[model samples]
Target: MRALTHLRSLLGSILEKKGAAWPDKATIEPPKDKQFGDMACNVAMLTAGKLGMKPRDLAEVLKSELLAADPALSKVEVAGPGFLNVTFAPAFWQKTVEEVLEVKHCFGKFNLGRGRKVQVEFVSANPTGPLHIGHGRGAAVGDCVARILRAMDYEVSTEYYINDAGRQMRLLGESIWVRCLELLKKPVTYPEDWYKGEYIIDLARELLTLKGSALCDLPPAEGQDICYEYGMKSILDGIKKDLADFRVEHQVWFSEKSLVAAGAVERTLEDLKSRGLAYEDDGAAWMDTTRYGDDKNRVLRKSTGELTYFASDIAYHADKYARGFNTVVDIWGADHHGYVPRMKAAVQALGRDADDLKVILVQLVNLLRGGEQIAMSTRAGQFETLADVCAEVGVDAARFMFLSRKSDSHLDFDLDLVKQQSMDNPVYYVQYAHARICSLFAKAAERGVAMPECSPALLARLDTPEDLDLMRLMEQYPDTLANAAQTLSPHVVSFYLRELAGLLHRYYSANPVLAASDEDLMRARMLMLAAVAEVVRSGLELLGVSAPEKM
Candidate 1:
């Protein structure tokens, strides 16, 4: 990262000398082809038109200036008509190990956000049932994204939006009440559309034990209300426990009912009507979502005097903006893909940029066992809960596999494969790399060799290709965190750790640390490996996975 900063500043000064403005689109990154150079830049192409010179000719001028100005650059070549490919001296790369040792756990942190507030609301499933695998994926992604932003110095708050005011809650209560009647040996007509899950019977039994048969003798409406309150509280408590077990925590639990109770929903509708964004037609209130690129206007209130879900959503988001969040992120299931445009339009109607509201849609997970798909249906309640999966595999494996790919891509969570201790399991492979390094330190200490203090003279011994590769990857951590934060993707960190772990595993196998002939060389290798373990641990922490000292 320091190398990148230095290159950007040096290029800006060179452009100043040439009397040309710096181009904002210029980029400096590692070359795809290692033979080209260590780092490649396109400043020449970006600024050539302004300077009235050919790209290759401008590259030549920049190359000459670079070699004269920076002694750290070992080679500067003008390649392929416009690109500047530069390689740094070995000493420059070796200094990265010292930087890691000096900072330790703070190695990858940055001040990119400058204390901007961000709100990430995720896995806000209605409390009608337990969480299934689809919700698990959203939970992993949302929590990891929040963690990545926090590492970049963003002030982040995570929330769970409770849909407790909707018909779903009413149905949950009726389902439990019917089951309670059956438990009391009373003849009841169970609706075909009611929720069917063993958990409903369990909740009925719990309510019966607490309130006794008196609950069954009450009026149907009164019994349903009592059942609704008890069911919502019990199910929500279980959801909290399951999420905590998955290492996901929410700072706020916002209730949709609260919006209606506080008259926020009515106030929001009035605000829209004042702006001419709302109009009544056919005895119903409508929002002109078409004004902001929606295909059709959206309904805010029905003719029956009942507010639609969109009305409450508008009020909820208005409250979010009023809370001073610079950005609001919503994580939803892939089934909600069609709702994205309408929600964006609603945000625009509220006088905010559509980009200020970010939505991440997580695709479904196909649970498998030995290459066979396991069927799941949330409404029928014939599904595997998140707690079940964690109990079988583990919290670490579940979280890692949930983040193994982009949130929009479908994931096959093979239960048996994740439990294996072989290299086929990604979590095991990365954790083993850290464990192996810790073992190496233990072996060295037994033979009376303590880790050497990191110094320029000592690190000069780490000139092997393996040592430099590890250092290069470690130097890219801060950049990886920044990219993940900007793109709102935590899968980037998962991919980075796998690559870093692969390099470290190969290095561990081919090189000898304690058995080396030279004492200083052994000490140098030990220090480098220690730095690598630190980076591996840091990356795994970002993914909410554990780094064990032993497998």
Candidate 2:
């Protein structure tokens, strides 16, 4: 919890004398190739350009300044190309681990955004059908974004913008109703492009029970719209159940129906007109988004007077801003990438800063069995569900697998890897490390051995190279959290878990924790173990995965 000691002073000496501020970012990067040092920074070199001094010379000055500020520095060498490779004393690294223990699973949860209100709208898949595998990826990524922002002390509202008023919803209702009429042995006409998924047939069954024979009297083709509406609701209910089974929750299910009913969509168009960002053109209402750096103009309403998707989006974003969110994030699939420019333009057209709204587009998820791709279509009810995935593997395995890759990258969801529950699985590896630690504690207790407190001076006992390596990683956790937030990549936390788990597994295998009763040694190592526990626990929590004390 202590401020980064000597590095701050060294940088301060250079900047304060020059009547400036210390560089806002002083990263403690592992030497790119690892031979440079445990931690390295180019602050001195970064400042050299501003200070009118050679970078090497600046590093030399900063080295002396650093040692003077804190004796924790074992060595500070100015490497080639003006890099400052820093070696901290063994005790310094050890104490970092102990701090992790003290903080428990709360380690690395930062308040970067303070208490600002933020809204994350993701996985707004139309209520017309169940979520497909692709939707699952967005669901996980979007949910994690909200989780991380909340962890960083932001008041985040996780919402789902249901497209209940769209063409898709209407089509869905028709599909289900047509299927129901077919089941009732009545004359029916199904649309060629109607939903063909078995879920539609299942939804028809639900409607049969809800409305019974009353639907039999309505003309088949005529009542299809009503049936479609009924089906959309039934499908949405099923979608909610699937998401619930996956442990994902939303604060709001803001419907497009609400937008249209409240006149918000029309009102937004008027708002744009008042700002001169909109105009009537060629049977279409166009937004001059190119003026604001978009690729071209966007249509808000068709010349036919029907509202366009862009129009609804404008109203949606306006509602977001009106709700007073400091930040608004939209998570959409990769195919929606083209929509980003105009959406941002819409926010700006509505007179809100584009920067206030952020959009994250997650790439597709290709479900694979063996090495071959698995074809899953929710409309066909042919794909796997998150609920099915959870039941097959587990909540932890499902979550970890979903989180193991970057959102912007395509993920191959492998049932074999997730179901095996082996060391090859990263989730099991981390969990096993945690379980191993628990076993160690159980054994230690059985031996009538008690863990001693880490004295303020006990860190000095941790003087091994491996011990120092673990500490170096510990110091980077805060940066890891910040980097993940800034990049909107939750997979970084996934990477961190594997890295820390590797360290702990290696340390446990090589060292004998019970070799001696040396209180200082035992206390130091135990504290490090506790710190490892805290980090793994905190990391799993971020992904909404549980870290069990037992495997």
Each candidate structure's count of clashing pairs: 0, 4
Off by over 4 Å in 1: none
Candidate 2: lDDT of 442?
81
Q: Give the alpha-carbon lDDT of every model.
A: 0.93, 0.80
TM-score, prediction 2: 0.94
The C-alpha stretches of model 2 lying farther than 4 A from their native spots are 1-6, 18-28, 46-52, 219-222, 516-520
Candidate 2 local lDDT, 236-258, one digit each (tens): 88888888877788989998988
Candidate 1, run of 10 with poorest lDDT = 187-196
Q: Rate residue 461 of model 1 by lDDT.
A: 94
Q: lDDT of candidate 1?
A: 0.93
Residue-by-residue lDDT tens digits, candidate 1, 53-125:
9999999999999999998888999988699998887788889899998998889898999999999999999
